[model samples]
Target: MTDQPIRVLVCDDQELVRTGYVTIFSAQPDMEVVGEAANGLEAVHEATRLRPDAVVMDIRMPLLDGIEATRRLAGPQAADPPKILVVTTFNVDAYVYEAFRAGASGFLLKDAPPAQLVNGVRTVTGGEALLAPAVTRALIGHFAERLRPGDPSRTAREDIVRTLTPRELEVLEHIAQGLSNAEIATALFITPETVKTYVSRILAKLDLRDRVQAVVLAYRIGLAGGAA
Candidate 1:
């Protein structure tokens, strides 16, 4: 990693929750809590102003919601967006998917262990998607209907298929199935570094920002299906 500590912005409506997050993140030798926000509007404003390396966003907030705030900070229209790590209570599973669609790089349950929270920030900051396997399965299962074939993007899907080599396609399929680089390596009997290379090539060839989009593309193109 870089010598600079990762800058983090914590946003949560609950003061107690925000404090807890700050404490956990600030304790990391490689992290610095740059700012805090109690609502979506403040989150967007502070995140833009501070330009933190990563944002720990809450789903529910006053004024606006985390998803919209994330969109404002990191969506398709955004320029030089920072990585966003959405933290939420498991009760809001529906909103979690929307947060990802709005350009969040990763997410975690609010009740996850402190170490997981720390790792989530670092994962996003490193330009990696930080979805747990179970979360990935749930997300794909919840959105399966929206990913059916025969969409207007059929030609684009076909082009994507034609663009990737057979091995790259295999890597994409494993990624869509919520497999991490190491897991994919084991499954394919290749080294994890090799899997990483393939992942990079796949993203570059497909013009995807991260694994989240890769999973979405795999589903849309029939390379993956709802979790079994």
Candidate 2:
């Protein structure tokens, strides 16, 4: 962790939602609410000026929208982007997929418990990503359903799988199955700490940004599928 607090920018069109987040996060000593934006355009401007460590962004905002804002801040065009957490009140599947595709580091339900919210911020700030179990499964399933023989990136994904050690490969398969770290450890008879280490190593070896990416990779490489 850095010596300074984890700075956060909260963006939500609803005043109550923004106030709620600010109130909850500001109570923590390790984090601080650095700024607030009512719309996606303001979010981009505030993000540029404040450069907060993480952003709690809502998907539907006035003017520009979370998807476009996220794309601008953490997408392909970004030079140096801050981590973004997409927290929405809805559980619409398309929204979840779009949030991840937009390069958000994490996704959370707007009503998630305070602890989960806090942990989500910390996870992204630590250069990791977080997705709900349902969202994770959806991402993998989405990719597998569209799998094609002549896909241009197939070979690259296969190469990523080839680099994984035997143990890491096992972990990857379980991740695609939507198992949590503790559950994976229990099923494999390994310690959770060991599972954590394996997960980190798998991400490094596979050139994945986080577990979410690892899940997608597993499905892409045919390790996890309908018959998996």
TM-score: which candidate is best?
1
Deviation from native of the Cα of residue 72 in model 2, angstroms: 1.5
The per-model lDDT (C-alpha) reads 0.87, 0.80
Please report how far candidate 1 places residue 156 from its true position, in Å.
2.3
Report the C-alpha lDDT of model 1 over 116-170, residue by residue, as the tens digit.
9999998988877947777777766777777677755677667887999989989
Candidate maximizing lDDT: 1
lDDT of 2: 0.80
Candidate 1 C-alpha error for residue 143, in Å: 2.2
Q: List the residue pairs that clash in candidate 1.
A: none
Cα RMSD (Å) per model? 1.7, 2.7
Off by over 4 Å in 2: 134-150
Summarize candidate 2's per-residue lDDT along 64-171 as a digit string, tens digits: 999999989987578778999998765454666566667788788877898988888998888657556665565556556654334535676577667888888788
Lowest summed lDDT over 10 consecutive residues: which window, candidate 1?
Answer: 219-228
TM-score of each: 0.95, 0.85
